[model samples]
Target: MTVDLRDRHVRAVTPAEQSPHSYFVFADGRLLRVGAGSTRCDPIAEVPSIREIGPGTGEGRESELRLYVHGPWVCVTERFGVNAALVNTATGAVRELSRADYHADVSSYSIGFLDRGGRTLLVAQTRWNRLDVFDAASGACLTERIGEVEDIDYFHSLLHVSPDSRHFLSNGWVWAPVDMVRVFTTEAFLTGYEPTSIPVGTAFGYNWDRPCTFVDARTFVLALDDEAAEHPYRQLAFFDVPGEPDERLEPHTLVSCDVFPRNEHGEVKGELHYDPESRHLVALTDGAGAFLVSPAGEVSARLPDLMVGGHGGQAGWSYAPRHRVFFRWNGGSGIEERRIQDCDRAEP
Candidate 1:
């Protein structure tokens, strides 16, 4: 049941400007901007002819948790977390998969759907030493991988599969200090590979993340707060993963930056924005301001607070590789597309 996601068919929720191009398809045929766990896209065609499919058994309560989107299908779970459903993007079809397997009692912690078909893969965490996987079509477990995962202890674990399904990461899932982040080759992990961790920090114990950007098949940039073994003068560590599937993930260029002091009010501090075009990265230190740095690690520009924010791009700009520009947006506001040179002119 794989759904083909053709050109501009990608889904997004934060960058509202992506609405016209990237989209989330709904059962009712409306293509809407992206939202978490329960939002449906308004189908692109204005398909008045496509009738809305009403909720099936054990579904369509007042609240729906729209978790992940793959192709045209969206994984919908309920507020109770015990139940899960998949809404077909094309036919508006809905089915319940969570009610089966070990999920009769445990809600799945993370989900992955094969992009070409609608098969569901779920990951659930329990008791640190073990994890559970439930297969959608088979309504059972991939017992082999489950036994392997149980031997690895990932703290406060959550699972994420890469866009190409080649790599995955296990770390703190929600909003908490991103302290122990680890990346693994998707193939190696499933096939059972032993490895050493690429250290991010040591010395002092403070860390956070702006979401690791998976820029390409082999190149991704990760930001974290740490002292790293015994280094002084810097509190941040940036690691560039070697990305060879079987090789150790040693840092090709592990750069560190001056510690951006956190806000005493508990607000998040020191955000990073990478503009691929300029090959630049921006760090917005709360209460202070923002500074743009070159790939060689030199400060290039100092930016002011976001016009509306006392800080810089919170959910600010992401490099739109397709558009060759920066896509900037805040909350539900409209998005702004800008060239990297237009930094001073654009907000965040």
Candidate 2:
């Protein structure tokens, strides 16, 4: 399905009811609001309720709020002190998934939501380097363990699950300071399993963050940062899952533009979306314009007049097979629904 960018309209949600930092959209077109402020879309009955899952650093600054949706259910994770919750979206039900009792010194964490068979699973990573899973319906933990990490803070990274719900992927640092991508199977987890690293050089190193969706079970893309510096760059790289030995994942610098300059200190400040069905990759950058890349990594379209940028947070653009409407998030603050019209499927 090809979306017409010209027929789109954009609007911002009221800022008073939103948290300046945290926001998420549910699968059913309902928005899961967050942050320290109250939302006009308050008391989201059919959506997950936001509450202080853990203790904060005195002033109660929330670290992260993530919403995971599968089918009709949405699971929300609110991280504060050392606790988190797995809430049911269909009903206003909340259950504590983790607390300070699990990891005393846990100062940071990440959560991944996956649907295994007919059940929903909530996986939590504590600041003390521990991974735990809980039943989404009952909040009963199925497994827990102290992960293979000495310093938990360095483990800060992104978590993504496969479309098939068979594999879970995480990118972060473990024993060493080098970046690593680890894959775990849901089937193995049910029988007491842990993630295994693909290979040595398969994971992108130097600097990497902001993971886009999985192009397939084996291919995924991430925004690259400079190798030696802390700055980010407008570069994309593709690596085979279960990577081959000596395989080096390098950035595609040809995609960079004048706004997204290729420098040792430039960062890829924007949002990325991968359309699985059409094999289209859309990149919205602060410095550059909105660009569409073919599955082969060739530029297909660029909308420079609609240059919009921010922290380049979560921007939604998904193909609704049922509705036939290509939905997109307008600047991460509002949504723009566009009807897909007839367009040539030939590669541009």
Candidate 3:
């Protein structure tokens, strides 16, 4: 089911809906909302009630929306900082979970909601190498000082919680002559817990231009300039996070050819997404091509018609029962619904 680009049925959101800060797809696609500047706007004509959640007051700047969905409750992170807010869509009640109440020095940090053993948990990390956990429902402190490490600087890289909620992984670069890639896990750093060093090496130096994402518990997909040449080459590598030094996984280059195009300034622009279930890696190139890779690092499918812009515009389809939807943005203005069917081959 390919949606036509010229369909007049497409709705235009109000000027308020154009916020690049807090756009989200919620309610299983029934709601398409955009929150930018300070106000949240419902762009779709289907949901007309514009209920204000709260004022956007914070510092770090809202990068993405970390929506925690458990049963009937939905919690959203603040525009910036370590603020977890609980919002009931049924009643529109909003509750703020502040870091001060938890007795943790988390003035500057980011948070993600995790579901641990059927209970909602808030996982946060501070700039000074401190981790904290809070009860999602009551905003009560669960654990403070989960882990403390000195000298390693976590420069705002991607922080991901595993599907099982048993571990949290952070990918960042340590401050050195050459930026080194490092991954930190919750299993190695809980309070009263001894830090266990994973046998993973510096995958690559920090190059903000390249795109990267975790595939599963021990695997990651990254695009890098393998030869340190002018043009960047995209590659996919899998590593064992908990394996020994000799048992550590080796990095493999899946794609050796040029996959992305250069911008007006001659900089390569690309985005990547990996499906852990199928071990399928999708690379959306700025040159208008999408490359699908297998777990064994093989290109399975290459769709040249798909155009993915930047890092945040890419979407993944779950293939458990194949009961999911596929949509893509045509530009900054609208989205095109691609397919609505069951995905029996991908992960959620």
Clashing pairs in 2: 54-81, 55-81, 232-266, 232-267, 233-267, 233-268
Q: What is the C-alpha lDDT of each candidate?
A: 0.42, 0.47, 0.44
Native-to-model Cα distance after best TM-score fit, residue 233 in candidate 3, in Å: 6.4
What tens-digit string does per-residue lDDT give for candidate 1 at 1-348?
222223232223322223333434332233344332222234432323221322343344333233455545555443223444555555655555433323211222344443213455654433332444446445465535434232433332334455565655554322232345566654454455324323323222333233344444445555544334355443334444444533334445555554254344222344454555567665555454555666565666654542213234353334433333444433333344444465544443
lDDT of 2 at 254: 28
lDDT of 2 by residue, 218-264 (tens): 56666555453454333565644543323334433323322233344
Candidate 3: where is the Cα deviation over 4 Å?
Answer: 1-110, 146-151, 176-180, 192-200, 208-210, 227-234, 243-270, 276-279, 310-335, 340-348
RMSD, every candidate, angstroms: 9.4, 9.1, 9.5
| The 10-residue segment with the lowest total lDDT in model 3 | 316-325
Off by over 4 Å in 2: 1-42, 45-64, 78-83, 99-109, 145-156, 174-178, 189-195, 199-208, 226-234, 243-264, 305-348
TM-score between candidate 2 and the true structure: 0.62
| Of 1 and 3, the candidate ranking higher by lDDT | 3
lDDT of 3 by residue, 1-348 (tens): 222223222222211112223333432212334433222234231222211232234233323333444433455543233444555444555555543322121222345557767677766544423456677666676655434544333343345555555554444444451333344455455443213333234345534325556666556655554544564554444554554324233464454544555454334446666655455666667555666656555556665555554345443211111212234433434443432122223222
Model 3: C-alpha RMSD to truth? 9.5
